[model samples]
Target: MRNLWNLIVQYHIALVFLILQGIALTWFVGSHGYPRGKWVQRSLEWQGKWDQRMSQWDRLTELDDLNRELLAENATLRAELHTARRDGVQSTYQGAEVIRSTWNGASNPFVLNKGTAQGVKPGLGLLQNNRVVGRVVEVSENYALALPLINKSMEWSVRIGPTGPVARLVWEGGDVTRAMVYDVPRSASFAPGDSVVSSGFQGYFPSGLLIGKVADETPEFDGQFLTVPVTLAADFRAIRYVEIATVQGRMELDSLANSNGQQAP
Candidate 1:
């Protein structure tokens, strides 16, 4: 303690001088308008920069939450539209993220981040951007598998328009952007630009859900029907988010059809 006191006594003069200097500088700045104004301006500038950086950080942190909210909103809107269609059943929707997908394969299957826990089940309809994407075929606790329209084995029941003829749309294992509509009657009147949509007969998507538009390719006559080429509206390669539609009473309807030894139209 005595040695510390001696050390303090030795440097006390310098400490006192430094303290006095600091006080003098403070007083000089306060008395001078120009110096004080410059100091205030610098302080404000530093504060503004710091605030901007903090705001950017906060936005970055909230981005994921914002995306989830958007997905929920979209699902609600879709459900409302489905109900408005009055397709003989009430429907609900849930949004999901596509974790994996394949477009260039014969049996193009995609995986979703939602499953039975989230009300996702087999035979549910998958939609993206208000257009039909696929149908859910399998499910686990937290994930589901779907077969897209690009799958060679997948055939969708689609119509040419709101009241047009219904035909089977199938992928012929070549182009990923196109599919062929078979069993279209030769008497059916449809142009190249007509919008093909779901017929709601397959028990997947409700009627009027857009599948694709008729392409400019010439229809090929196959005996009794005209096979038309269609340009698919959904881009399978870029699908990241989708909505799964669950039609109420669909299971009961399917069971009734099966009991009668027939398929649900």
Candidate 2:
């Protein structure tokens, strides 16, 4: 008790000043109505602002998770919208996050963080934003593999923009920057910037999904076909998230083509 008294004595003047200031503030707030009340209100307002700022700082840490969830929800809604427009026959789509990617000439495929648990299945069309990215080739209980359009063996039917001819879009194996569009009529008027889109003739993809833009066009010797170069819409090298399109009648179309020995345009 004596040591405590000596320590208080060392700062007695400071302690007295603090106590007097507190008493004065209380008296001013209690007795003075307008001016002191306004000051107190303003001080409380400042404290409230600080508290709000701290709350926002805490919420900032969840921004990424919020964005991802929003993206997934948006994809689901878009798929539902498409299904509605198709008279409820088109299969619903689901979103998936890419977990692994490989592109060393052994087939370019991506491993996604979705599988049967998420309604993901093999043969489902994969897309990014609004463009076709690939198709699901394999699926497990927890994950799936996607064969991206950049792979040398990948091919899809696509139509040129606004009445232009339809053709097969395929990667040429060596050039990653471009793909070859086959069977375009040499007489078809095409420019370097014409847009290409999914034909949806085979039911593997939705009509109007962007394929690429024409990069160049070369006429064959017989002047019957054009060797068209196309730049893909999806980067493939930097895809982070994707959606899988569950086509409802894709199997029927595939069986028909196999039986007839004909391909869809």
lDDT of 1: 0.79
Extract clashing residue pairs from model 2.
Answer: none
Per-residue lDDT tens digits of candidate 2, residues 1-265? 9999998999999999999999999885654322223443344345434544553554566774675687689788977788668743465677776766655553566667676778876778888888888887766656676788777656788888856777888886665667888898867787788888888775667777888898865534345777788988888777767888877877887898889898775
lDDT of 1 by residue, 1-265 (tens): 9999998899999989999999999876553222223443344345434544554554566775686689889999878876787758777888887766777767777767776677777789999877999998767656676788887766889999889988999989878889999999999999988999998877887778899999998999989999999999998888878888887888887888789888522
Query: Using lDDT as the measure, which candidate wins?
Result: 1
RMSD of each: 23.9, 23.8
Q: How high is the CA lDDT of each candidate model?
A: 0.79, 0.72
- Which ten contiguous residues of candidate 1 have the minimum total lDDT? 31-40
Q: Where in model 1 is the C-alpha error above 4 Å?
A: 1-65
